[model samples]
Target: MQFTQLKVLAVSGSLRKSSLNRLSLESMKLLTPTGVEFLIYDKLDQLPFFNPDLKNNPTIEVLNWRKSLKQANLVIFARPEYAHGITGVIKNALNWIVSSGELLGKPISLPNLSPRASIAHAQLSEILSVMGGDILESCSPNASLITPYVIPCDTAKNLCDIAVINHRIRELWNRIETAMITK
Candidate 1:
């Protein structure tokens, strides 16, 4: 009934500091259940393009990225649609690990930022699935309607979007626990 050492690693396709997707990940961190550490990976830019030659001898950044993937019990991705497809940065990161098989059997939560991003999410889902990741459908938050707004607000409706994010995370935690127990 109790779980420990749970670390959720979040990676967003957007590199911009002001990206709504990135801010959503930050918000999700606040709603993590006790004892579950949520971390956002911010070094995607430092990783080089995936190269077969470099795989034999990877740089420190690449090494660290792969290590982070291995360290996480669950990997959550918040990606925005760029031309109806995955962002180059996140795709590149995936390419780096696809051949290494570090994420095989790893549970990944893909929060589809709906409306504007369903295509990108579907594409990413197929990609991760091919790479052997177990995508948790319950954790897939359809945040199409929730605008990323974090500020002092008078209306309860403004704050309710945060509830949407929290609800998705809670669903993820519950399903993960159920899966672990059944296994």
Candidate 2:
């Protein structure tokens, strides 16, 4: 893809302030390369439950969410798995845009914070693919950081303290840049 500027929209499924998934995205912001705009879509919790009836006139929050997705060159998601599946919060967000097709042909990176959550990762990949998103397999790394439901700390500093986690974050960004060049 040839672009004048690359805008990346990062999203976290967890609503908690101490979520490692969100912390990881924050760390990613610090390592974002120049000329790339990294924005975190933090209003997933504000979106109303997906109902087909509201397609004609969606809520303001839904409109804003779709706008961000449509405007981004890439979408990076860092979500924690729940009960061996994707969290309801992220799933609900995707459902809101499934019919609108905002993710159609968009590059998506769904990085798993917990290595044990393979089932959720696969489910998310399938959902994104069904939404017509180009799942960047190379950029989606199994960043072995936390367990399925545990929060290490409240700050990105705690998550970035581990050298391996930091490397994985940097590598994820590198893979994203490389994907942009080779797309």
Candidate 3:
């Protein structure tokens, strides 16, 4: 099977301009393979708090968020943990789409930059699983464990080894291509 294009939507849990999670995903945009469309979703902060009553009459932001999710062949999340759990921005975004089923059976990758963030990673996995997402383990590479010399996100500069970053991005792109081709 061959694919002309593979659409991947990258979401960041942190809303800060210089967040490591956001920067890492932004950098991956440059390394995407040919015929792959990688979009970094930068509107988690724009979404309103989820309310079951508003599911039928969602705001424009909610509609746009769901549309992005529906159009992508796969969704990748680069998120930071707050108090040992996923950030509120990501949680809220997921909540908004949970009832609508945009993520139902959708392939998802949640890559972690820090080894100590395992708790948050597990939480995210559980949530995505409950939402009916196909959590792709192949795409969720931990930057710290991938490269021995690389340090975790303790500093802004020493995020991860360049080789690991490239490898992870390529792996993700390969998964996207494979999934698209198989579908």
| Root-mean-square deviation per candidate | 4.0, 3.1, 3.3
Q: After superposition, how far is residue 121 of candidate 3 from its true place, in Å?
A: 0.5
- What is the full ranking by TM-score, best candidate first? 2, 3, 1
Off by over 4 Å in 1: 144-183
lDDT (CA) for every model shown? 0.77, 0.84, 0.78
After superposing candidate 3 on the true structure, give the runs of residues whose Cα lies further than 4 Å from its correct spot: 1-3, 145-161
Error of 2 at 136 (Å): 0.6
Worst 10 residues of 2 by lDDT: 143-152
lDDT of 2 by residue, 48-117 (tens): 9999999899999999999999999999988888999999999999999999999999999988777677
Given candidate 3, what's the lDDT at residue 124?
Answer: 95
Q: lDDT at 176 for candidate 3?
A: 61
Q: Mind giving the per-residue lDDT tens digits that candidate 1 earns over 49-123? A: 888888889999999999999999889888878898999999999988988897899888887765677789889
What TM-score do all the candidates reach, one by one? 0.83, 0.90, 0.85
- Judging by TM-score against the true structure, name the best candidate: 2
> Could you give candidate 3's per-residue lDDT for residues 101-138 as a string of tens digits?
99898989778777667889999999999999988886
Clash pairs, model 3 backbone: none
Q: Pull out the clashing pairs in model 1.
A: none
* Residue 183, candidate 2: alpha-carbon lDDT: 68
| Model 2: CA > 4 A from native | 1-4, 144-151
